[model samples]
Target: MNATTVLRAVGGLLALSLSQQLAAQEVPPSLAELSLEALSNTKVTSVSKRSELLTDAAASVYVITSEAIRRSGYATLPEALRLAPNLQVARVDARNYAITARGFNSAFENKLLVLIDGRSVYTPLFSGVFWDAQDVILEDIERVEVISGPGGTLWGANAVNGVINIITKAAGATQGVLAAASVNGDQRVGTIRFGGRIGKGRFRAYTKTLTLDDLQRESGAVSLTGMQRSQVGARADWERPDGASTLQGDAYTGALHQQGTADIKIAGANLLARHTVRISGGTELSAQAYWDFTERNQPNAFIEHLNTVEAQAQAATLLGASHRLVVGAGYRHAFDRLQNGVGFGFLPAKLDMHWGNIFVQNEFDLTPEVRLIGGAKLEHNNYTGWEFLPTLRLAWNPTASSLLWSAASRTVRAPSRIDRDFYSPSNPPLVGGERRYNIAGGPNFQSEVAVVAELGYRLNLLSDFTYSATAFYSIYDRLRTLEPNQAGAGSVFLNRASGRTKGVEMWADWRVTPALRMSAGAVAQQVRTRLDPDSRDASGTTGLATGDPSSYWKLRTAYDIALGHSIDLLVRHYGKLTRPAVPAYTTADVNYLWRIYPNLELSLSGTNLFEARHAEYGGAPNRTLSGRAVGMKLLWQPK
Candidate 1:
């Protein structure tokens, strides 16, 4: 649909809602519920590694609150991420997803960094996340902070494009038993959780399971089989006058079915501990540690057993009346054991990787209304020895409800196993009297780098309206590419590509009434790439890193129909893809909830209501089509 049509639809919906609300006699919504003013004042830590009001944050950040998640009726993390306008999320299969920010979107997108409670989840093999393997109890999540800019200055390497931080609620906040279940034609999910007290501490334990049916291709043929997963986890928190501590752990196992092949199996477990103490001179010291293990076996593909251990510590304090400083250091180690498959594999099979970084950031209060922030990180990795990331930001608060900010930063995506050690044909054989492989990793592969600049503005009108906008431009160098060997052996990975990306992200929230709210978000971006003059890259790797739409927009509305009834509607439009030639499409989703009792609720949700089936990613007959989905959920929470 064109922009005009979308605008008309949104206007019609708004007029209808206003008319209905005007005729109703129900009371206003409770103040305890989320409000536009509350949303603007939401505390976000991803922007500067310190808690601050969302509107005051200089970075292009969006916060997906718990209330939004509960109302959307999304069952998976990737689906929830769609609420962020700056992000591009595509479902690849029954279990896999491709998600990124700005541009350079792909299944193996390496520039975006993701963290769950301060623990990184990207795999060393590709410097990307396995969306299928990463799961969390949606009900336990507090908020998801998404920043659509380089965060490497504080987050370390691989944060070249953006960062997503998934933060969960404290144990004490969930002090009762909660159970939820949802089922649709293609999927089913169930979860049960209980929280109580343990000697001066609060504890919670939960278990969850999900099953999905097979999906069909554009030709109505089954493309991929179903998948299932089961998980159990627990969290405990202790709080004192001066300090707090937390411990959490989770374990999961699952399998994905494949046609004419053995099922792919996956299992993993993680444990994390964190502590924070308020020290003298208003200084706060915090420390975190985590151990993660993952195993995946794809018959005829590959088998991997990976273990990772990481530790980090940071201190935040005021150096003087005008400066706030933060200093930290981190170390991570990974042991990756790979069982080569007949088709391709990482050479040497087993390897050990280490990473370490130290960062320092300071915010100078140049004046009461102005601030300057500067930070840098020195990171060392096994593949790319040492890299530097730095950022400078300036923020000016012209008024109590208006903020203008600008930033410049340098970030990098360090080489992964795929770029340094991968080899096609685990055992190469003689081809035309020459032993050759189709592809080989490059020993000289270097880190991909990006220098980015951003400008943003935020405005709030009273307690009823808020808006945010950010524009960014990035210059990239040493991008990954595939170069043919001089000896005609095969193509090898190399740094032979460069590119530039520019984009704008915008979002707004309007409280039409005390019981009605509306939000709109949109993104427009362009990516341009070129091959180095002396490099001969035959694989068209320049375009391989990006598969994105020129523009996309979404409009959402939430209405409280009655004292215990609410309804939410969302409309999204995506532009066409040039390289893959995917047609443009518009979709609508709706959800309705009824609170039967103070502690019990039921909801019905429908997705892709405007289409029978559509493809969001991939090409041709091989791509899976997402069909219309309708589901009902029951949630119970005991006081």
Candidate 2:
């Protein structure tokens, strides 16, 4: 069907839902049963890789529950992340997202790691993520765990910046048919789901799809590069008095056919099983196994296809009433086959790669108010042989309403397939040789490692207010860089330099009443890199220095209206970037949502709300990295 037809149909459904809500508003729920204190004290898991009360956790963490998602009216995962503090969200074009935590934001941001129910989503080809290819039914998500800072001791590679864990609800929580659709300026999204109980377990399945309008050019002209995506997922759970276990999986099959541009199609899947056992010794043992795969193809791009596979197993046990121990290992094997074409070189041979790691951690409670945590991980990979990572943490609970914490950790980021073994053509013809010379990949590149120290405090200020603040300093060694070689236009990846990154994050929340809430967050960071004593900058200089402004802030306000209704407003501001070639500019966004009914909702959101002419990063004169985009959506669930 055409876009217009689909939109009209969705509009009709939304009208009916709104009418139903208006008819039911006469009888609102009692105010005594709901209050603000209860919402701010909710528990979360992303901070420690385990569940804990938000007020009691040591690290900085944020929780956006299912209700929050519904009330915000966001149509996609990336859209929702804009509400988070310390997060940098930017659109680099028609099909790229520049998202990061603290700093180092880019289209293929490598500092941060994202997961859906314990499943890692990083790609082996670029050592980054393709946000456009990742989608989920927002309604099915129980909560989003956002942690700022290193999660290496627990999460492994690419956890240098932070971790975003998208946790979905179990089958039992959603027990009926649900259908939702949304429309706005240039994007449309729809979702459907069903849930029920089986013989011995509960099972639920869902599908989400989206079609985005073409991106706008600097002249306000559309790029004719729009894309479409679809995703399907399911979850099952079993619980008897004896214990509880759960199994979950998802499959994403979609085509990114851009008009008049190179089209790429991808298919992927993820599966996981978790088991928890309570022992007579008062210790709990838990284990989980997970795997993810992705296959992609871009007919026009020289680098034609990439297939990746990742699998992992982890186990944890409580050693005593005050000590918790964890140990587990896993492996990742990726195979890449490429074809040569314009601006690209052929892969003389296919590449086979493997990554393995094992880790352990101990949490000790020294006193009723003080606790300590320590851990380490050993990793082996094709490029880097044996490597070790260690960490230590100290936490103090002054009262039931506040916590102070500090941590020290060392971790590494291994090379990708392209970094260790791949070839490419040169851009802007080299000083010598043919118009293009293949870039060289090395098998001797050392892993990127860093030592990070952090301190933070969390406080429950008043009956309806909460706040968290954190500061960190990191020293990086063995950074990878490329230099022109004698092999015509050839460049190699090697351990070339050292750098330092320091930053602070602060967030505050205030509940004006049971129906009104407000939140604000901000980040200030700086990074500086210098060429090694024996190394040379791209310009042949002995030293070159640079850093991005890395400063940004966000504000949000929400109200829960009568009769199961709510509305939210959000505004985000990005600071002017000033380093590594300044194309700096600031921008803002506005978003709103309305819960038309308990089982239905509608949302309207837009980025670059003022159509600000700004550049978050990159320095291409013709770069259309800044603009405005608006969208809407509808969600429905029948009891």
Q: Pick the candidate with the highest lDDT.
A: 1
lDDT of 1 by residue, 1-639 (tens): 999999999979866765565455343343224567777889998888877799889999998888888888888889889888788887777777879998888778888999999999999899999887888888889999999999999999999989999999999988899999998668899999999999999999999998988899887789766889999999999999898999999999999888889889999999999999998787889999999999999999899999999999999998988888999999999999999998999997999999999999999999999999999999999887989999999999999999999999999999999999899987899888875879988999999999999999999888899999999999999999899976668889999999999988999988888888899999999988889997888775677555588899999998888776799888888887765556788998888987655567788999989999888887776888878989999999865
In model 2, pairs of residues that clash are 181-634, 182-633, 183-632
| Model 2: lDDT of residue 535 | 58
Task: Estimate the overall C-alpha local distance difference test score of candidate 2.
Answer: 0.71
Please report the TM-score between candidate 2 and the true structure: 0.88
Measure candidate 2: CA RMSD: 4.8
Candidate 1: list runs displaced more than 4 Å: 1-33, 430-435
List model 2 lDDT by residue over 387-485, tens digit each. Answer: 787889899998877899999988777777666655565233656555445566655777778788999998886577788899999888887666665
Score each candidate by Cα lDDT.
Answer: 0.88, 0.71
- In every candidate, how many clashes are there? 0, 3
The estimated TM-scores of all candidates read 0.94, 0.88
- After superposition on all C-alphas, the RMSD of every candidate to the true structure, in Å, is 6.7, 4.8
> Which pairs in model 1 have colliding backbones?
none
